[model samples]
Target: MRRRRGFVQFAILHLLKEESMHGYQIMKELEERSNGTYSASAGTVYPALQELMEQQLIELDTSSDKKVYSINENGVKHLQNKHLEGDFWVEWKERMMWRNSEQSIQLRGAVDRWEKEFRKAMKHARGNPESVHELIAFIDDMTESLSKKSTKQGDRS
Candidate 1:
């Protein structure tokens, strides 16, 4: 996915404010928090980390062959000055969700293929009661499951 300018920097420092994290872990955090969006590659994350280090916004500790990064005093001050807290993170996540809509690349591709297959099946199954009943039952079951999930999510909110 295409990230906005300075997006990587903002994400790295934002996460560093919480705890020291290795580069891989930081990438995973971005992926998780962004809901499968903004998965920065090593090439992207390392350079950002290096730049943050050069700017003295973050400190690195090498203990177990991994460079763990933590936000320093300067980073904390920068974070505070920028005021990038809950609202900012929520906005960033929303943007990421828009960019990476449809859940995932795999899901998008699968949905496209599945749709074509279903259309073909419907065309062939015309005037077939058994096939129609089977498809309707499957769709009903899926709809019921999805309805339950939606209700649970609404409860959480």
Candidate 2:
């Protein structure tokens, strides 16, 4: 849903690296492998598979009832060149789990700091309207600074 092109591509390549599967099978595999974090709907998976077919990364197994797909030489080369062999998604999922936990901790720390800062600032401005004005000015300045930094980074990227 987030429209991560790289993530989708990586999933396809990873799936093919293991073995051949159909679109539905790939979707089920992805959901199970990612622990439900990454799910490729038919709409998304089918189109991506079509693109990969067009790119000659995979070939269809038209000799069966189900339209299965297997990695071709190009797909194998792609996987090998990418240095992503084995169940690469497993390691990625593990790292993501740890990263999420770390982020939760960091978010808690940030929220606590923000609360403390806000309380202190409010206490200092209890009777002075000028402090409120200064707070607004500070917020505006920080917003402008963040906007500029974001714009510059986007430009660089």
Model 2 weakest lDDT span, ten residues long: 1-10
Top-lDDT structure, candidate number: 1
lDDT of 2 at 152: 98
lDDT per residue for candidate 2 within 10-115, as digits (tens), equals 6787788788888889988877876765556888888888878888988999888999888888988887777755568777676446545768779868878987
Misplaced by over 4 Å in model 2 are: 1-4, 84-87, 94-157
Which residue pairs show collisions in model 2?
A: none
Roughly what TM-score does model 1 have, to 2 decimal places? 0.57
- Residue 70 in model 2: lDDT: 85
Estimated TM-score for each candidate: 0.57, 0.55
**Which whole-number lDDT from 0 to 100 does residue 85 have in model 2?**
50
